[model samples]
Target: MHVTWGRNIGTTVQSEEDLYFSANSENWFDMSSLGAFDTYTSDNDWVSVEKMVPPVETDDMITTRDVSKLCEDISSLYLNEKFSDVILVLDGEKLHAHKAILARCEYLEALINDGSQHLQQSEIAITDVSPEAFKKLLKFIYTVSTITITSNVGLIVEVLELARQYCFKDLENATIQTLKSALNLKNICSTLNIANLYDLSDLKQACHTFVDQNALEIVTGDGFTDLSQKSVIQLLERDTLLVPEIEIFKSVSKCKLNDDDDNLVIGSVRLSWLTVEDIVSTVWPSKLVEDEKLLGAIVEIVEVKAKTSVCRAKKCMKNNHNWRKIDL
Candidate 1:
């Protein structure tokens, strides 16, 4: 806020900048620059505005405690169909709700009130979501709280999917955060798969970062093999993957043995980074030999080895360094 003091004598200006954007009008501003202090009054001869102080905040404490009971009462009314106007047929189970559910949820509002035939009957069918997960969603919508998602990865995944499908962005974000807390090496791949499939950008980044930072252990784990071909390709493509290229190729080979994927590219790996002996004895003579994609990589390795030999012959070269041996 830029506050400019007027130079004119006997002029007073009282002002309040709504920096916080609070609804209260009681903002106190000392206006001594205009004139000498006098009794506070709503007079214009001077900057006669009275100081406004916001009322005390006692209501918030009360409301926070009262909202739970209010939610329970409203939920009771909904279940008893006291004023319910709609029924959700979730996997053959009837769930009662008011028209407000449509108002609160985007997909429900679109499906129920946007000229669907089901609107007339006040009944909508949800065939994909399980009844229990649907119930958990309703509880959150009605109570303004999320169900416990800790150590309940499956339930969290289901709810997270529902949140995304229904366009509940706040709930989707909350579920993603919950999923982040639950993530570990064991379930990282599965969570990453869901994040990718559901297009959860933040969660996807989190999973990718976790795997990239722990690439060594992760690549050796069972979860790495369980990853979708797309996930594996993405992991391999990241320059941030810190595991040795040799281990990565081993894991990729294992994955290839179980499921044939044409999209798995080996170019991301600096094949030259593998020692020449290792390449000749292990990499080339083994599984890498049959793969056509590695043909160029194998050639690159040989070229690097030749360069290293020349550098060694030059003697001035430090450790016969081959620039191609460096991996990004």
Candidate 2:
């Protein structure tokens, strides 16, 4: 019997004559026919397919295992996980604390040398700083270990705090040296105040000694006005040698003879032996020969009275003819 086949179907024989073509062959023929239908239709189908299908993205999975591996790699340098733990602990502390430990480490390294060769040769004793301290120091070096001076006075003082807490002698010495360089009368006052508060006997003594030695500069200038009365008194008391020049005399008579005013005069009768030459040189150039002769006579008479009375025997000085002065 004759049977109708779908359009574009390929010829295929079946067991029965009812249908000789297969639907698969007809479907393949239909798909090939669709390609020639229209470019727009093919484009539309592709566009719809693309919109229906979600975009694929590359996955960058950063898991805890990866982080742990990274940390393990870093910890390999020290060959210990405990060091990594210490680093994590250091990260949790204050940023300054971390920096201080680092600075201390650098200072220790410079002081001791690589592999502690210098430490061994010099035989210097190590204090509270141990292997753990070095680990903390490294954590600081890798993290933050810089101390910034925001205020003028707090810089060295804060360093001292760190040094004291960590028992770092080098750091303490560095702080003291910096303090010495920065010290002025005003700042020294603050340093002294801190020393008192902290009960730093050595620092207090150093400040006191510095102030005492530089008293002239610190106590007499415009800067001195800023100092308290107590500070001034303390400086003055300690620096007794800074007292104003004193006019010494064997007796009151010697002190009074050197009259403050003098245009020109031959040897004055009251001039002491110690100042006799000075009086002669100053007066000799201006005096007449007769006046010089008169001055010499007056000097002799005063000397005679001075020797007999010791400037206290009234009768001895009264009997001397030189005691009765003439206008000449």
Give the winner by lDDT.
1
C-alpha TM-scores of all predictions: 0.67, 0.29
Scanning candidate 2 in windows of ten residues, the lowest lDDT window is 244-253
User: What is each predicted model's overall lDDT from 0 to 1?
Assistant: 0.64, 0.41
> What tens-digit string does per-residue lDDT give for candidate 2 at 107-167?
5446445454542442333444333434433443343333333345664575566566666
Best by TM-score: 1
lDDT for model 1, on a 0 to 1 scale? 0.64
Q: What's model 2's overall lDDT?
A: 0.41
lDDT of 2 at 23: 27
Model 1 residue runs over 4 Å out of place are 1-27, 30-82, 114-116, 119-123, 256-263, 289-328
Report the Cα lDDT for residue 86, model 1: 89
